[model samples]
Target: MRKLLSILMILLSIQAFAQDDKSKDRIDYSGEYNGTFTDIKDAEGTMQLFLYQPDKGRTSGIILLTRIVNGKSEVTTGTINIEGNGEFISGNFMPSEIKYIAPREDEDGIMQNTYDSYSCRWEIFGQITDKKGNTIIGKAVPANCVESNLIEFRINKKK
Candidate 1:
């Protein structure tokens, strides 16, 4: 009877330890977020973010942009940083430096779409309120070359 009690006690303790370790594991931030930059003119789009654990003890993700450029699809994808316990999360996605299109008035004073290139990017860093919550990133540059550091976008995890 004493031996049986000792084994049961050890099993219980091990179970408790396992639960404790699971709680300390990183909170899952993988999901799709829809948002719009409130501070930029004519800025409206959807941001799909996919996060995964690249290896032991680290995290990374990709940011997919749609309709942020003149109705053309552009994307920014890369790593982002999340603060302790997922209370705060932060990351930046820079679109590859490549030649894209630009629209402007030609010498004839008529609107036209021309090809040009610039370093376009969008960054997200803010508090998550909770494991499943809303967040506001302070700055987001649209797919175009127009740089606006004062731009801010409110993101909500889709239900």
Candidate 2:
């Protein structure tokens, strides 16, 4: 009976160590990430992102700038909280809102000016790819606004 008890204790110790190591292997996504928005028309720009873990199952980041379309840009200098569930990523933003709506063509063959507020729920469906081509698929939901005036882009972490 003593030998059997000893074996059980050894198994429990091994399990505990395994759990500790697994937690230590958690990925650290806290850094400046450069990526492009890939799902928009005439969208060509890079975004600087700062990511951090505020608590368990919660990650937050901020976009320094979102340059989309020529001569048009939006600055999100405020903090945006993002949460992760499994392979999904989502968040929201406020205090930094700008809109660029499409101009309407008038009879004079000129575009009419129309100003609107920017409110969009930015959604990205892609993966974080490494230099070796390995990808970590995920999604991001921004809480800045409900409807965007311009097209959105999918971002892949830049190398």
Candidate 3:
């Protein structure tokens, strides 16, 4: 009975240490990331993202994108919050809310078709890669806009 009890205690101790080490092995994903997306027309756009994780399971960031519309360039910026699971090596991303920044008139008056208010709800689904610089591959869409096309994007972390 004494030997059996000792073995059980040793097993428990090993389990506890394993759990502790697992947490420490989680990847840190706080940095600037740049990505590109191809629209339905096959035109490519650029994405600049600043991401940080405040706590386990919660990742938040500011994102900016520039795309061509009707031969003109349009820029949009927003805030994104998502629930994260998996290490920085690879994982799932669940968006909580993605809201565009309040709009403003074209200050220079050189831009066309600009709006005073830009509203959008974005949904992004994808995974983080384990490759060099940890590339990100995903699909992004304007979830509330029916006319918007889905964009497939790949991003890499900046050094």
Model 2 lDDT tens row, 41-119: 3444555667676434466777664655446665545565665433445555443655556878989998765542224
Deviation from native of the Cα of residue 105 in model 2, angstroms: 12
lDDT of 2: 0.53
Off by over 4 Å in 3: 1-16, 87-119, 131-133
Sorted on TM-score, highest at the top, how do the candidates line up? 3, 2, 1
List the pairs of residues colliding in candidate 3: none
Pick by lDDT: 1 or 2, better one: 1
lDDT (10s digit) by residue, model 3, range 1-159: 999999999999999999889877666677898979886657678987788876544677787777886799877787776555552332223233334344455758553432222235667776777733267787766654524666688888999
Give the per-residue lDDT of model 1 (tens digit) for 1-159. 999999999999999999889866656555566676433455455655565643323446666555457667655444454433456655666654544566789899997655422245555566765555445454544444444433456667666
Return the TM-score for each candidate structure: 0.53, 0.54, 0.65
| By lDDT: ranked, best first | 3, 1, 2
Tell me each candidate's RMSD, in Å, in order: 7.3, 6.1, 7.5
lDDT of each: 0.56, 0.53, 0.67
Cα deviation in Å at residue 147, candidate 1? 3.2
Candidate 3 has an lDDT of 0.67
Candidate 3 matches the true fold with a TM-score of 0.65
